[model samples]
Target: MSRLRSLGVPAALFAAVVAVALLATLGPSAVERLAVTGLVNLILVIGLYVFVGNSGVWSFGHMSFALVGGYVAGLLALPTRLKGQLLPDAPALVRELTAPPFVAVLVGGSVAAVVAVAVAVPLARISGLSAGLATVSLLIACSVVAAQWQSVTRGQKGLSSIPTSTTLWTALGWVLVALVLAWGYQRSSFGVRLRASKSDEVAAAAAGISVPVQRGIAFVLSAFLTGVGGALFALQLGSINPDVFYLDATFLIITMLVLGGAGSLTGAVTGGVVVSVLAEVLRRVEGGSLFGMDVPARPGLADVVLGVVLVVMLLCRPSGLTGGRELRLTRRGTGRGDPTREPSGRLTPVGAAGGPGEDRS
Candidate 1:
C-alpha cells in the first residue's frame, strides 16, 4: 500500500496522458487538437525549464526561438508561389530556398540555436534580473521585428501554407526527446556547473566554474529545443503569427516552471500538463452560458489562473510541485522530499539511484 501511494502520482499521470492520446486518436472532436497543443506547449515549457529551472534564472524570450523557428520552417515548407505571394518582396535567396517538412524543421531549430549563440555571447555576462531583463528585451524586440517584417514574415498577416504534419505520435517523440535531453543535461558536468552558478555564482566562480560559458550553453541548448517545439507547432497548425509567442505565452511558460518548482524536470513537465488542462477547462466554462448570466470568455483567464497558482505555490511550497524531487519509477524508495527542508537536494542521474555529493559544480 505504501508503495502504491508512492507510485500513485506517476501512475495516474501516465494513465491520464495515455488515455488522452488514445481518445484523441480514436474519438474525434477538438480532443486531438487540444492534445497536440498541450504536448507542444509541454515541449516548449520543458525546454525553457532546462535553463530556468536548473540555472535559477528567468528568460521571457524563449518564445522568440519558437517564433523564428516557426517562421523559418513555415517559409521553407511553403510552396514557392505561395511564399512569393505572401512575402512578395522576399529576397531571391529566400524565394529560391524550400525544404521538406523534416529538413525545414531541422533548419528552423538550427537557426534558433545560432541566434541563441549570438545573444548569449553578450547577455551571459550578467546575472539575476539583468539576465531576465535581457531575455525579455530580446522577446519584445523579436516581437516587433516579426510584426513589422512584412517582406519576410508577412508582418501581422502571418505565414501560411505550412503542412499539418505533427501528429500525437510525432509530438510524443519530441516529448521523449525533451526528457532524454533534460535528463542528460542534468547529469552532465556542464549541468553541474550551471546549477552551481544558479545556487551561488560567486562560489561557483571561486570553484573554477565558468559561469558565463555554462549559462550561454544552457541558453543555446534551451533555444534549440524551443525552436524544435515551435517548428513542430508550425507543422501542426499549418500557419503561425508573431502573436503566438508573446507576453501571454511567455508568462504561461514561466508560471509552469515556477509553479512546478525549478528543481525538478518532472515537475516542469507536470506543471505544463496541469496548467494546460486547467486553462482548457476554464476556457470551456468561460465560453459557455451557465445558469442565466452568461460567463463571457475572457481572453486572459489562463494568465489570471497562473498568477493565482504562482502566488499559492510560492506561499505553500516554494520549491514547486515536485518539491525538488523527481519521479524515479525504477528506484527503490520514495521520490519526494521533506517540505521543511530546502529544495536543493542533489538529484541522481536518471536510471542511476545514487547518493548526493559535495559541491562539485
Candidate 2:
C-alpha cells in the first residue's frame, strides 16, 4: 500500500486527465477543442509551477516566453511561400526555414530556454515582489519588441495561415510528456534544492545550496516548457498576435497556479484543470445561456467574476484548494503523510504534510 501511495499523486492526476479526455470523445467537436485548450493551459501551469511554485517566486512574465515560443513556432511552421510574402524584409533564415509542427515546437522550446538563461542571469539575484516586477518588465519589453519588429514579427500583425497541427491526440501526447517532465523535476534534486530555498532561503544557502543557481535552472526549464505551451497555442488558433500574450492571459495563467496550491505538483495540475473549467463556464455565461436560463451578454464579465473569486480565495483559503497538500491514497509508514518530512526525516520537496504549506516568499 505504501508503494502504491508513493505513486498516488501522479497516478491520480493521470486518471483524472484520461477521464476528461474520454468525456471529450463523447461530446461534439467544440467540446474536444475545449479539452485540447485545457490540456495546453495545464502545460503552461506546470511550467509556471516549475519556477514559481517550487522556488516560491511569483512570475508574472512567463507569458513573454510563450509569446516568443508562439512567434518562433508560427514562423517555422509557416510554409516557405507564405513566409516569403509575410516577411519580405526578414532574413533569409527567417523567411526560408520550414519545419514540421512538432519540430517547430521543439525549436520554440530551445529558443525560449536561451532567452530564459539570459533573463535568469540577472533575475537570480532577486526574490519576492522585486523578482515578480522584474519578470513583468521582461514581458513588457518582449511585447514591445514583438510589436515593433516588423521584419520578423510583422509588427503586431502577428503570424497567420500557420498550419494547425495540434490535434486532440497531439495535445494529449504532449500533456503526458509535460506531466512526466514536471513530476520528474519535482522529484529531482534540483527541484528539491529550489524548494528548500523556498522554505528558508538563509538556511538553504547556509547548507551550501546555491540558491541563485537553482533558481536559474528552474527558470530556464520553466521557460522551455512554457515555450512549448506557446507553440501549442499557435497550433490551436492557427494564428498569433501580440495581444494574446499580454496581461489578461498572464492573469488567467497565474490564477490557475494560485488556485491550485502552488506548492505541490498536484496543485499545479489541479489548479490548471479547475481554473480552465471555471473559465469555460464563465465564457458560456458570457454567451447568454447558462444551464437552461437566458443570461444577458456582458462583455468582460468573465474577468470581473474571476477577479472577485480570486480575491475571495485569497482572503479565505490562501493556501489553495488542497491547502498545499498532496493527496495520499495510503498512509506511507514514513513521515506519517507529512509532505515536508521525507522518509529519512528530511523535508519533502515542497512542504511538510498537513501544514498550511503557504509560500513565504
Candidate 3:
C-alpha cells in the first residue's frame, strides 16, 4: 500500500533505534543519560530543518527561539511555589501567565512566532551572509537579555523544578509534527517559491513573487517549531540555564546541518540522529585505563568528532550526505515539468501553428 511504502523505511529504522535504546538503557548511568540527551538533540535538529532545508539559508539563530520558548514555558509551567521561592516580586505576571502544560507550550511557540515576524521581516529582505549575520546578532542579543533578566529568567541560576512531561514518545510526537510540516512545505506553492528564491532570487522577484514575504513566512514558521522544540527540551530536562543556549550550541547545529546535507529534509533528520548518536558514543569513550592508571577523556571530544565529520563532508561532497535532494521513491518526473507535453494540456510550439513553413490551408 502507498501508506506502507511511505512509512516503510522510517518504521524499520524506528524499531531498530528503539531496540538499541532499550539495550542501552540497561547500561551504566551515563548510557541512560546519553539516550535522553540524544532525544533532545533530535528535536533541535528537526526544527533547524524546517528553515535550512526549505529556504536554503544558513541561520545560526534557531537557538534564540529555543531560549524564548524554554523561558516562556519555564515561566508558565514552573510550579507557583518554585516561582515564589525564586522570585517573590512578580506574582502578577506569574498569576496572569499560569497555564496547563500543553497550553503553556503552545503559548511559548506562539510568542516565538510573533517575535520571529518582527525580527525576520526586515532581515528576510536581504539574502546570503547578511541575513545569516543578522540572525547571529539576534541570537547574541537574546543571550544578552536572557543572561541579564534576573527577575524573569532567574539570570544564570535559571528557573528550576520544571515538570518532566516529555518522554521519548512525546519527543517522537514532536518529531512527527516537524516532519509533516517540513514535508508539506517542501511540496507546497510557497515552498516552491522559497526554493526558487534560493535558486535565483532575481528571477523569482521578476516573476511577481514577493521574495521577502516568502522568506519571512518560512523563517517565522521555522522559529515557531524551533520554539516548541525548546519547550519540549526544557520539559524533558526539568530545568534550564542560559548557558544551554550559546555559540557552541549554535555550531553543533551548523555541523549537523552541513554534515547531513543542508537542503533536504531527510538530510537534516539524518544529520541530527547521526551526530547525536556519535556524540553519545564518544562520550562513552573515556580514555581507558593503561597499567592501572586512568586517562580521562576531556571535554570537547564531541566537538572534535563533529568538526572532523563536517570537514570530510565539505571536502568530499559539499552538497551534503543527501546531495540537497530528496529520496522521492516515486516515479521520476511523473507529475513534474513541461506540463504542456502531457496529453491533458498539450500545446503546439509557438511557431509551429502559423510559421512560414506551414502548409497552405
Candidate 4:
C-alpha cells in the first residue's frame, strides 16, 4: 500500500499528460503544435526539478545541458548529405555519421549527462549564490561557443534540416520516463539524503551525508533529462540555434518549476500546465484584441505577464500552487505543523524523532 501510494503522484501526472494530448488531437494544427511544445517544456521543468527541487540549489545553467543535447542529437540525426552542406568544414567523423532519430535522442541525453559529470565535481563544492552564478557563467560560455563554432553549430544561423521526428506520443513517452525517474529518485535513499541536505546542509553533513556527492549526482541526472528535453525540442522544431538554449529558455523553465512548487513532483506538473495554458491564452490576447484591451503587441507581453505572475506568486504564496506538497486524495494536511504531519514531511532531522520514514542509518 505504501508503494502504491507513492505511485499516486506519477500516475496522476501521467494521466494528466495523456488528457492534454487527447485534447491536442481535437484542436487545430497550431494548437496541436503548441501542445507538443508544452510537453517539451514540462520535461525541461521536471529535469530542473530533479536538482533544484531536491538539492535546494538554483542552477541557472541547466539549459546549457539541453543546448548541448539538442545540438548533438540534431547533428547525429541530420542526414549525412544535409550535414555536408550545413557543415562543410566538419570533421570526417561528424560529416559521415548519422543515426535514427530515436537513437540520436538517446545519444543526445547521454552526451549531456557526460557534460554534467565533467562539471559536477567542482560545482558540487559550491552552494547558494555562488553555485547559481557559476551556472549562469556556464550558460554564457556555452552560448558563445555555439554561436562562434560555425564549422559545427553553423554559427549564428543555427542548425537546421534535421527530421522532425518527435510526435506528440514520442514526447509523451519521454515525459513519462522523466516523471518515473524524478519520482523514483525522490523516494530513493539518494534523494532522501539530498533532501536532508537541502533542509540543512550542515546537519546533513554531520549525519554523514556527503552533501557534495549528493548534489553532484542530482546535477548529472538532471542534466541528462534536460539534455533529452533539448533534443526533443530540436526534433520537434526541425531546427535550433544557440539562442534557443540560453537565458530565455532558462527563465521560462525555472518559472515553471517555481510556479508549480519546486519542492515536489506534483508542483512541477502544475506549474508546467498552468504556464503553458496561460502563455497560449496571453499569446492570442496579444495578437487579437490586446492593445485596446490594455495590452501591448508581440512577445514581451507574455514575459511581462509571467514576470508579474512570478512577483505575485512570490509575494502572495512563495511556496507555489502546491505549497511544495504532493497530492493527497485520501487525506488532507491539518496545517498544524505538528509531529503528525504527512509522511513526506518527515525527512528533516528536526522531525526525525517520531516521523514516518525517518533515516535511522
CA lDDT of each prediction against the hidden true structure: 0.77, 0.83, 0.70, 0.85
lDDT of 3 by residue, 172-284 (tens): 66666666666656555677777777777889899998988888888888888888878877877888888786788888877777877777665676677778777665654
Worst 10 residues of 1 by lDDT: 352-361
Q: Evaluate model 2: give its TM-score.
A: 0.90
Worst 10 residues of 3 by lDDT: 350-359
Cα deviation of 276, candidate 1, in Å: 1.2
- Residue lDDT tens for model 1, 21-74: 666666465767888988888889878978786677778789999988898888
> Which of 2 and 3 is ahead in TM-score?
2
lDDT of 4 by residue, 65-126 (tens): 99999999999999999999889998988999999988898899999999999999999999
| lDDT score of residue 167 within candidate 2 | 85
Ranking by lDDT: 4, 2, 1, 3
Clashing pairs in 3: none
Q: What C-alpha lDDT does candidate 3 achieve relative to the native structure? A: 0.70
Estimate the TM-score of every prediction: 0.85, 0.90, 0.83, 0.90
TM-score for candidate 3, residues paired by index: 0.83
Query: In candidate 4, which residue ranges exceed 4 Å CA deviation?
Result: 289-299, 329-361
